[model samples]
Target: MRRLPLLLLPLALAACNGGTGTPVTIDVKSDDGDNGSFRMENGTVSIKGDGFQGNFRVPQIKMKADDVDLDGVKLYPKSEIAGFHITGGDKPGNGKDGGKDGSKGGGKDDGKVRIDFTSPASLAAVQNWFRDGFTKKGFTFASRGDGFAGTTSDGGTFTLDLSADGGQKVKGRMEMTGS
Candidate 1:
């Protein structure tokens, strides 16, 4: 009986260490069906674990876009982020970084549309919106800093910024050219 407990100890430890964690992947695409690609190079994200924590380093990422080439885009830790949250569809506040605010109304003035989601499903939905939204609006965009910038086919420049909080929440920014 004493030996039985000892033998079970290692088995229990192995079970806890099983490598079955799911990895998160983000894909970016353009709306116009134009041929272009976006890539993320040299990035790191810190994830909080229960009692224990971990970090991941992404050396590179390859994103396929319809019209613009984003092969050189990259993301790195600007500062330590904690307690991240993800929201979707016309949120009021800006992302965790307090970068830019999102707008509610949908129109030519809406310019940029922001969507927030955590799982792949939500991200896919948002990407689809990006495709349709820009296409319907007739706009061309390019990656700018930690966000994007471009001119609408109607001759309006817009800026959009998206931030993810440790796979918890995503916030968006939709700012028109002037004001």
Candidate 2:
């Protein structure tokens, strides 16, 4: 019974595009000769065939920054959220850190959530903001190839990467996985 929600998380996260209250049918066919249809309507998804059948309400993600929570993770000031999504742990492998050598060695937690945003602040400023905030929250930070990684006292993990988006805007992504 517990696995049901975990299994549904991928489907919900994949199909969610902000419901429009209109019904739509999607036929899915794979090279393995397995096929099925997914019907989405009014914030609900129904599946048929392929041995995966059920109806689940797609979880709504809040676009407002104040309503978003990534444990104690904080978004950069004046950031405008562009996208958000989550993946359950049961899906296998680790977070994006799963290596190219097929080694699953990072973020062994219950789930992972990511938020994409842009801010009209300098890249250095954004990095400093997160560094200060995470440090104050008892997270130890380490530099990564692309950005930085932090681990909380409770074993949760988070990563932040920011790059200039031309002019004064900076684009970034924050991913958290654990507890």
Write one digit per residue (lDDT tens) for candidate 1, span 1-179: 11322332232233232232222222212222211111112343343312323344443222112212112221121211111122112122322332234444233222232222222223334344455566566568866654567776656566656555444344444444411
Q: Give all candidates' CA lDDT scores.
A: 0.34, 0.62
TM-score of 2: 0.57
**TM of each candidate vs. truth:** 0.28, 0.57
- Predicted candidate 2 versus true structure: per-residue lDDT over 63-178, tens digit per residue: 55454545565676667777665544332234465533565746445556777788777777777877777778778888775468878767778887878888688888888877
How many residue pairs clash per model? 8, 0
Q: Where is model 1 more than 4 Å wrong at Cα?
A: 1-124, 145-147, 166-168
Error of 1 at 79 (Å): 26
Off by over 4 Å in 2: 1-62, 91-110
Best of the candidates, TM-score: 2
**Candidate 1 least-lDDT 10 residues:** 74-83
